[model samples]
Each structure stands twice: as C-alpha cells, then as structure tokens.
Target: MTMSDDIVRMARAWIGTPYQHQASVKGVACDCLGLIRGIWRERHGTEPETPPPYTADWGEGGGQEVLMTAALCHLMPIDRQTPMEPGEVLLFRMRPGAVAKHLGILSAAGQAPRFIHAYNAHGVIDSPLTTPWQSRIAARFHFP
Candidate 1:
C-alpha cells in the first residue's frame, strides 16, 4: 500500500484507544502526541527522541512553540497554506496567544476532510476537519 494509505490505516487501527497522557501503545491508550509517536514507530523502528512529560493543559502559556519545534526537527515541514491530505501532521494552537500544542494526522481529504487524534474526552477518533479546527492549525508536516 502507499505510505499515505498505510498511515491512514494505522491511525484507523487506533480508533477507540483511550486517551492517556504519555502512553503510546495502540488499543491501550495514547495522547495526541502519543498517537503520532506510535505511527512513527510503526514505520520507523526507533523514535528520533523521547519526549518529556507534558501537563494536562499541554504546558500552554509556556511561551515556547514546543510542538512546532519538535515537528520541524523530525517531520518534513509543509507550508500551512498547502491543502491538507491524508497522513499529514497538523499542529494546532488551542488559543490565539497560547503555544501551539495539539496534533492530529489527516485521515481523509476533499470536500469533507477528516483527521485522527486522541482527544481528551473523545479518545482516538476520526472527526471532520471543520472550519474552527482548520483555523487553529498553526503548521503542517509529514513523515520525514
């Protein structure tokens, strides 16, 4: 299968996985970052680097773009203006002045684009990439 297809497939497999901070095993639990980390491990044997623990609020207001920096270091950068497609990594800023911290993997694209993420109360699920979600996207990337 194509890499994009593989990524979507793997992400789908994590559907129903409970959201748990710092966890990464599929079907058990994972946070948004953990979901990305798990998929990376599926394609690459080792993680580029281990992440330090993050708080429930995602360490917001820290004045540091931690997530963006990490994505730049590992994933291939994609212009935020570029249309999103399956397998693309999405980094979001929860609020206007807050640090960009959320992450998701595009699962579908076109008229009704969708993404997979380990949401706090929703677990790992594919959801529509609605306007609000689109607006919060601070950057995009793809597996290196």
Candidate 2:
C-alpha cells in the first residue's frame, strides 16, 4: 500500500474516538488537531513541539494564526489549488474571516471526497466534503 493509504488507515482507525480538548489517544479521546497529532506520531517519530494551551477557539482570542503557523512548521505545505488526495491534511477556518482553527485528514478523495475529524459533539467521524466545508478550507498539507 502507498504511504497515503497507511495514513488514511491510521486516521480512520480513530473513527470512534471521543472528542476531548488537548488529548490524542486514539479511540479514547481526541479533538480535530489531536486526531492529526495521533496520526503524525504513528507516521513520524515524535511531535515537533508541544502545542501551547488553547481554547476551543484556539486561533480566535488574539486573532493569531496559531494553528496555521504550527501546521506550516510541521507539515509539508501543499499549494491551495493542488487537488487533494487521501491523507493530506485540511485546515479549515470555521467561518469566513475567522482564524483557521479546525483540521482533518482527507480520508477519501476524487469526486466525492470525505474527511475524518473529531467534532465536539460528534467525536471522530468521516464527513462528506460538501460545499460549505469546501468553502472553509484555508489550507492543505501533507506529512513530511
């Protein structure tokens, strides 16, 4: 299998993880970024750096691109126009003009792309990449 396949498999393995802020143990608890961090540890050796304390609006309080900055530091940046593939990371803004604070892994690509993410109330789920979600995509990256 390809590296992307391994990443996808690893991400999907966390499908039922309960959403918990600042946690990354698979199947037990994790948030959107936590899910990505868990997969990162499985693929890469160790986390680049521990993240600073963050609220649900991790990027909003001070209008800092906290998540974006960290993503750039750790992930291989993908051009925005690049066609997404399974295992690529997606950074979402949550809403227009807001700091991009949400994240997910592309689980299925091509015509009907889908992503796996842990939402506060929903936990980890594979969600359709609909127009609304598409519109919120601020950036994309892949494992280094």
Candidate 3:
C-alpha cells in the first residue's frame, strides 16, 4: 500500500480513542498532538523526541508557533497555498492572532475533503473540511 493509505489506515485505527490531555494510547486516550505522535511512531518506529508538558492554553500564552516549528523540524513542510492531500498533516490556527496549535491528518481530499483529529469531547473523529475549518489552516506537512 501507498504511504498515504498506510497513514489513513493507521489514523482510522484510533477512531475510538477518547480525548485525554497529553495522552497517546490508542483506543484509550489521546489529544490532537498525541494522535499525530502515535501515527508517527507507527510509521517511523520511534519519536524523535518527547514533547514538553503543555496545558490547554499553552499556545495562547506563549505566542509561539510551537506546533508549526515542530512540524518544520520533523515533517516535510508544504507550502500553505498548496492543495491538501490525504495523509498530510494540517496545522490550524484556532483563532486570529493565536499560535497555530491544533493538528489533524487529512484523510480524504477532493470535493468533500475530510480530516481526522482527536477533538475534545468528541475523541478521534473524521471531520469534514468545511469552509470555516479550511480557513483556519495555516500550514501543511507530510511525514518524513
């Protein structure tokens, strides 16, 4: 199977995981970043480094693009203007003037694009890439 297919399959495997801050155990609990971290481990063996402890308000308080920075360091950066493809990582700015913190993996692309993310209160789910969500996309990357 293609790498993108592999990514989608692996991400789907965690669909039932509950949302838990800073956790990454499949089918048990994980946060958005944790979902990505778990997929990275599945595809690449081991994580390059462990993330530092962070709070829900971590990004807003720091004013730093920590998520984007980490993605740049480890993943293959894609131009923001580029069209998204399945299996690619998506970096979202939750609000204007805020650090790009939320993350999701593009699961389907085309007329009705979809992305999978560990969302608070909803757990891991494949959400449609609606206009509002698409507008929040700040950067994109691919697993390297």
lDDT of each: 0.90, 0.92, 0.92
Off by over 4 Å in 3: none
Candidate 2 on 118-139: residue-level lDDT in tens? 9998999999999899999999
Q: Which ten residues in a row have the lowest lDDT in candidate 3?
A: 56-65
Error of 2 at 61 (Å): 2.7
Model 3 lDDT per residue over 53-130, tens place: 988765788697788888899999898778778999999998888888899999999999999999999999999999
For candidate 1, the per-residue lDDT at 76 reads: 95
Cα lDDT of model 2 overall?
0.92
TM-score for all predictions? 0.95, 0.97, 0.96
Runs of candidate 1 with Cα error greater than 4 angstroms are none
lDDT per residue for candidate 1 within 4-40, as digits (tens), equals: 8899999999999999888999999999999999999
- List CA RMSD, all candidates: 1.1, 0.9, 0.9
Clashing pairs in 3: none
Candidate 3 has an lDDT of: 0.92
